[model samples]
Target: MSTKTGADAEMDAGGTETMTVREAIRSALREEMEDDEDVFVMGEDVGEFGGVFEVTAGLMDDFGEERIRDTPISEAGFVGAGVGAAATGSRPVVEVMFSDFLGVASEQIINQMAKMRYMFGGKTEMPVTVRTTEGGGMGAASQHSGTIHTWFAHFPGLKAVAPGTPAAAKGLLKSAIRSDDPVFFFEDKMIYEQEGEVPVGEDFTVPIGSAHVEREGEDVTVVATQRLVGESLSTAEALDGEVSVEVIDARSLYPLDTETIVESLEKTGRLVVADESPISYGVHAEIAARAVEEAFFSLDAPIERVGVPDTHVPFSPTLEEEVLPGEEDIQAAIRRIY
Candidate 1:
């Protein structure tokens, strides 16, 4: 596995290329669209505007309006349309501008998209991929900055993935697009420009339900998702010889890699579950619960959780910085656990 914290590694002559998380995601979409005719993208201002985050930039010129279609500013309508399209036959990749806006489309996402296959017993398929930007920073304010991925991760029938590195972003997204199930791909807006080595191949895909041990050590195991993954990695590097920290990126939130985390805990005997979501019954809670359930004997300290203190993300920049969890938070958690 690639170490999470490192200098910007240039593209080797081999199969991997250095790319930002945004570029990697765009590449994944382009490759997937080229491979499958059924795959199409639709969202507000996605075609001409290149999406709110510009992750879909230059796709329309390659695939034309039919494949890279733009939709009305109605999350419920377009999201429901994507679900319908998926049910019929097409593999639709629908982008919701902000994950915070997903609440407006919750009916389509939770009830219809998530349950259609199961509701139909074993006959139907919901090959819909919902891509949305998440997390604080960029001062998107309370509504747009909330890390609400825990809702979908906890909800039944939806596969949730939040990529930490560029490689994870590309691979997990390809996997999500190719999967027959509905997958919620949460992209942390703050990490779009973060660079990493990404495998360059059409067949390159990171399987859903897998966790990568980004860094290996013997003391505390820090299992983090999305933005926190990098933060935790940096914290681990800072600690260095002082504390042996094992950093694991919880890439797939729903089908979480509990075994990987459990194995790390078995060796390290301490854990810190960190994510940008709220601390109250969020991703941290779930990871902590799993560790307690499976690795009780390995526990040397109470599991520490680093996340927002059960509050909505603040609009003010100072308050946002204060409320959002980061490398310092991970460091503090590791210290506590150690």
Candidate 2:
């Protein structure tokens, strides 16, 4: 495990004050738009309403309506327009109100934007960022609260990034905006207001495909993504004397930092994956399969996965609590493997 020190370390305004995750993202977009002439923000309710969740709040006033254009409630049409604009030389950050709405514009994303560069043999660059809120925790119900990052991660041509911290959120958002490829930026709906220290000024980018070790130990490795990172950290603290568990955040899903995971497994000799998605054919399944195939010789026991049961996200709070992976589930998995 490597620690990002010196310049890589997040410093605040005057090298003292810190910013939140949402604020960091806001700063990134603000700075990028200010510095670049072609950069603009567009989507439904992005302008006057400042977005459904206000992620793009205040940008409309700052950048003006021409840059922060608002469109109708047509996901397919606006998404397609963003793709076309990106291909034609504009840097457009398109917001999908909910990740579940991606299904409505799958053709524009998977078929058009993702395949554009390769189809044109690298002659064109689709520099489009599809920003959307994902994951569950609030009472958003099934249709609004699914962890659909895996759907985009499954695509080869699109870059998938999920930031767990305010700093990661800021850095990764800048990197996604600058990239010449289509990026699916997944922001956990619950973490929107979760405060953390973030850099205040200048340009910084957290390179995609890199994983962060949130907490280090020698007994077992808990590989988590998005909100699961918080759960894993809590589980690690609770099981402090009982077992040693290392928590890793795979911030970027498609460009998964599997090498880091395999290396950690080599030291710990055990592994567990905690995800919000269902256990079957999900991100946890992919991680489990990769660890077994690549690090089987180092394992002391079978790899385990803690995730929602194989079913749609429940609307009832009781059923939802029962289905979601929690600290108890993570502790049980750790104890079983240990």
In order, how many clashes per candidate? 0, 1
TM values, all candidates: 0.96, 0.94
TM-score (C-alpha, index-matched) for candidate 1: 0.96
Q: Global lDDT of each model?
A: 0.90, 0.85
Local accuracy of candidate 2 as per-residue lDDT tens digits, 1-338: 24563214655223423666677778889999998979999899989998888788899889899999999999999999999999999999999988989999999998899998999999999999999987777767899888888889998789998887777788788889999999999988877777766655565667777777888999999998877888899999998887889999888887888888999999999999988887888788888888988899999998899988878777888877778778899899998878
Which segments of model 1 are wrong by more than 4 Å? 1-14
* Tens-digit lDDT track of model 1 for 194-217: 998887778788888888888999
